[model samples]
Target chain A: QQQVKQSPQSLIVQKGGISIINCAYENTAFDYFPWYQQFPGKGPALLIAIRPDVSEKKEGRFTISFNKSAKQFSLHIMDSQPGDSATYFCAASMSAGHNFNKFYFGSGTKLNVKP
Target chain B: DAGVTQSPTHLIKTRGQQVTLRCSPKSGHDTVSWYQQALGQGPQFIFQYYEEEERQRGNFPDRFSGHQFPNYSSELNVNALLLGDSALYLCASTPDEGFGGYTFGSGTRLTVV
Candidate 1:
């Protein structure tokens, strides 16, 4: 079973527009949700992360809106720029175990911001 | 501080051959994690290493083995490589016992022919 599911494998948005990518997960034990951004020829980097307690978190132009009960989360890039064009991934993790790691990830959303 | 670093930006290997990829953790980091990303796909967790031991592993098979050095650096070794083994191998570094986000390496692009 795909624990995490993301919509719109690819997306296109105008520069300065709002680029929204949504994801849903099946595991309620997951309390931490993080979003990652990847540019061409680079590894994915953690853009921002949020715990389930908060409804939303904003860091610069990137925002993560999480709905724990709904088991869904979304990333919104406000004032999207061509530089923001990259692949985005949503991941879930339970703060358990001595290992201290998370599990499950969305297929990833490729965002293209046209200038 | 210097970020995570990986070796061999690209590599080509024949099927049935073995290959090894290396990673150096970021300054001050004590944990290392490895992921596999196929073209046009999200990265898949292979395993994580801490305290020179394998702390956790993903759905990857035994063919995918790893070792962590005392310096927090790590190595990923794949045996009897198959076509499916070709992918971008990434290494992530983070503080051993913190909630900090991981810093990623540039990744080694592996092509199993």
Candidate 2:
């Protein structure tokens, strides 16, 4: 079973425009939600992360809006740039106990920003 | 500080052969985890090691096994490789206690024929 589900397998946006990707999860045990950006031939880099306690967290142009009640979260990238054209992945993990930090990742959303 | 480092960035093996991959965690990190990523797919967790012990594992088959050394380096071993085993194997590391994100290596591209 896919623990975390992401939508819009691919996305395209003009430079300086806003790009958004959404994700949903079913496991209530998940407490840490993180977003990663991966370039071809490289590893996924940690972009930003949020906890269930906060409804939203923003870092630079990247923002994560999380809704614990709905079991959903979304990533918003402001001022999308061509350099941002890559794959974005949302992951959920338990932050405590034995299963702590074992990430369950979404399939991923490929983003393209046309300059 | 160096990030996670994986060895033999690429490999090719025949079906029914065995393979081993190595990883060195970032400085000051004591935990290591392995993940398999198929083309165009998200990474699937294989297992995690802490304090030189296997602490948790995903739903992978027994053929996928791992070992963690006292120095916090880890190795993943696969017995009797299959074509389906062809994928990018990634190694990630984290501190023993923290909610911090993992640092990942570039990964090893494994191709099975």
Candidate 3:
């Protein structure tokens, strides 16, 4: 079963507009939620992360709005640009003693920013 | 300061053959985990190693095994490759099981024929 589920398998946004991607999880044990940006032929890079204790986190133009009670989280990009076109994946991880950091990733969202 | 590094950027093997992939964790990291990503699909966890021991594993078959060295590097071995085994293998590292601090390598693409 997919522990985490993401919506909008693909999205296209106009430049200078706002782009959003959403993800939901069923496992309550997950405490850390992170967003990764991946370009073609490259590894996924950490974009932003948020803990369950926080309702929201923003780094530069990237923001993660998390709803702990709803078991959902969403990433928002402000003033989206063509450079933001790439695949975005949302992942969740929990610390469980020795096995502490196994991450469950979402199916992934392909974002396209049209200039 | 180097990030996770994976060897054999690309490989091709026969269906009956066995393949081994290597990974070197970033400096100061001690945990290594392996993941398999199929085309257009998210990565699936294979297993994780810490302190040169297999600590946790995902729901993969016995054919998928891994080893961790004292140097904090790791290797993933897959036996009897199948066409479905063709995918991008990723190696990730973290200092410990914390809330964050995970890093990933570019990945090695494996093609099974």
Candidate 4:
């Protein structure tokens, strides 16, 4: 079973435009939701993360809006730039003891920002 | 400080052969985890190691084995490689305190013919 589901397998946006990607999860045990940005031939880099306690968290132009009751979360990138073109993955994990932070990741959303 | 480092960024093996991949965790990190990522897909957790022992594992076959050293580095071993085993293997590391996001390596691409 896919623990975390992401939508819009691919996305294209104009530079300076807002880009959004959505994700949903079924596991209520998940407490930490994080987003990763991966460039080709490179490792996935941590972009932004949020906890269930907070409905929203923003870092620079990246924002994560999380809804615990709905079991859904979304990433919003303001002023998308061509350099932001990469694959984005949403992951959910429980941070409790001995969990080893095993992450359940979404398939990923390929984002392209045309300049 | 160096991030997670994986060795021999690429490899190719024949079916029925065995392969081993290595990873060095980030400085000050004591936990390591392994993941397999198929082309155009998200990474799937393989297992995790802490204190040089396997702590948690995902739903992978017994052919996928791993070891963590006292220095906190780790190795993943696969026996009798199959075509389906061709994928990018990633190593992630974090402190044992929890909630610290993982730092991933560039990954080693394995191709099995």
DockQ (C-alpha based) per candidate is 0.67, 0.90, 0.70, 0.87
Q: In candidate 1, what are the lDDT values of residues B6-76, reduced to their tens digit?
A: 99899999999999999999999988999999998888889999899998998899999999999889999
lDDT of 4 by residue, A35-109 (tens): 999999998999999999999999999999999989999999999999999999999999885564999999999
Q: Give the TM-score of candidate 4.
A: 0.98
Candidate 2, residues B1-113: lDDT per residue as tens digits? 88999998999999999999999999999999999999999999999999999999999999999999989999999999999999999999999876778999999999999
Q: Tens digits of per-residue lDDT for model 4 on B10-102?
A: 999999999999999999999999999999999999999999889999999999999999899999999999999999999999998746689
lDDT (tens digit, per residue) of candidate 3 on B1-113? 78999999999999989999999999989989999999888889999998999889999999999999989999999999999999999999988734574789999999998
Candidate 1 lDDT tens digits, A11-74 = 9999999999999999788878889999999988899999988999999998999888889999
- Worst lDDT run of 10 residues, candidate 2 chain B, spans B95-104
Misplaced by over 4 Å in model 3 are: A97-99
Which stretch of 10 consecutive residues in model 3 chain A shows the poorest summed lDDT?
A93-102
- Better DockQ candidate (2, 4): 2
User: Which digits, one per residue and each the tens of the lDDT, describe model 2 over residues A4-87?
Assistant: 999889999999999999999999999999999999999899999999999999999999999999999999999999999999
Error of 3 at B111 (Å): 0.6
Give candidate 1 regions above 4 Å deviation.
Answer: none
Assign candidate 1 its CAPRI class.
medium
Clashing pairs in 2: none
Provide the TM-score, chain A, model 3.
Answer: 0.97
For lDDT, candidate 1 versus 3, the one ahead is 3
Q: Best-fitting candidate, measured by lDDT?
A: 2
